[model samples]
Target: MLHTNHAKHRMPVVTAVRLAAMYEDDRMLRSIRDLAPRPEEPLSVGEVIAQTPIGTKVPVTLFPTVGINRPGTDRWPVLIQGLEEIAHWVRTQAVPRLITGTEPPEPGLPMRYEISVGHEDERQAMSAGSTTSAGERHKKALAAASARGDLAEMISMIDGSPSEPQIARWLAQLNHEEVLERMSPLRMAFDYDPEVERHNFEVLKGCRDAALRFGDSDGPHEK
Candidate 1:
C-alpha cells in the first residue's frame, strides 16, 4: 500500500499546490464559515499522546481549509508516510472505536487528532525540555517543511535559524518517496501549471533529485 501510495504521490502535490493557489484566487473566499476559522489569536498545539481521539474517523466530503497563513493543516498533523496507512487506520481502528465507544486506539498512524487544546519564541521549534528547547526529530521534520522553498516559502515565509542545517538534513532524511507523503500539497499552483500533467509529474521527480543533492551535500564529494 505504501509503495503504491508512493507511486501515485505526484497528484497529491499537484492537488496541494492547486490548493495553495486558493487565497490568491479569491481573497473574498476567506470569509467562508464552515471552513476552519482563523483565530483572532493563535490556537494551542495540543499533545495528542495523552488525550486525542487517536483513531476516530469521520467521512469528509470537502477538503477542510486549514492553517490561515499556510492554508494547510489546522491540527498538528498525524505524520503518515502513505495514503494506505490512513485508510488502514481509519477502517481498522477509527471505525471500530466509533462503533464500540469504549475501545481506544493504539497510537501511531491511527492517532491523529489531539484532544488537548494547547505555544512563541516558544513557537519556532515549539518543543521544550527541563532546560530550554530540546525536542528532536519530528520537530526538525516540521522545520524542514517550513524551510523548503518549494513548500513553506510560498505559504508563510520563514527565516532560517541555527536549526537550518538540521532541518536540511531532516528534509533530506525524508527521502523523495516519503516527501510526497508528508507534503501539504506543496504550493505548485504558484509555480507549476496544474493543467499540464507531465509538468506536475516532473516536478516531483525534480524534488527527488534535490533530495539526492541534500544527501550528497553532506558528503566529502558533495554534489
Candidate 2:
C-alpha cells in the first residue's frame, strides 16, 4: 500500500534479469514454468511446495500456491518463484540486486482457503464490473450492520469476507476517515481485519470521494 518510485521500478528490472537468466537455457526454464500450476488448475499449497526445487532456500514468505482465474492471483506463483530464485542467486552469486516484473510479496500470514479464493474472485468481479458475488454482498451487509453498531452481525460477516482492501475501505467509511488517518501507522502494524480498521476505511473513502467528485465534472482547470 505504501508506494515508492523505487519499488515500482524494481519489478521490470527483476523480470528482465529473470528472463535473461532463463534465456541461456530455454528448456529448463520452460520446465520450471510448466511445473507451475495454471490459473484454472486447482493447485493446493502442498502441490506448489512439491514443485519447487528440492531444498530450495526462499528468502521471503510464500503464500499457499493457488490457481487463480483472476489476474493478480494468476501471477502469484510466477512472482513468488521469480523472487525466490533471484534471492537465492543473490546470496550465492553475490549479485547485489535483480530487477523483476513482479510486485513485492505481501507479508506472510495464516490465510483460510475460503478467504483467499473468495478474495481472488471478488477482485476479478470488481475489476471487470461484474455483479458482486454472494460473498461480497454478504460482506457489504455485514459492514452496514457493523456501522449501525451491531457487533454480532459484524462478527458473522467478518467470517465470510475475503481478506481484501475493498472490504476494509468500506468498513473504514462507517467510522469516518479523519480518525483513521491519524492512526494509519498503528493500523498497518497490528490490524488484520482491514474492514474493521478506522484508518483504512477513511483513506479509501477519501480516495473514492475525490475520484467521484472530480472524475466527471469538467472545469476550466481541467487538463
**Please, what is the TM-score per model?**
0.21, 0.18
Write down the TM-score for model 1: 0.21
User: What ranges in model 1 sit over 4 Å off?
Assistant: 1-58, 61-196, 220-223
The lDDT for every candidate, in the order shown, is 0.39, 0.36
Q: How many backbone clashes does candidate 2 have?
A: 12
Question: Clash totals for all models, in order?
Answer: 4, 12
Per-residue alpha-carbon lDDT of candidate 1 for residues 152-172, written as tens digits (9 for 90 to 100): 222122322213343355465
Per-residue accuracy of model 2 over 83-178 as CA lDDT, tens digit each: 444444443333222333344332211111244334547644434442333344455565455443322223224323322343333344444333
- lDDT for 28 (candidate 1): 33
| C-alpha lDDT of residue 208 in model 2 | 48
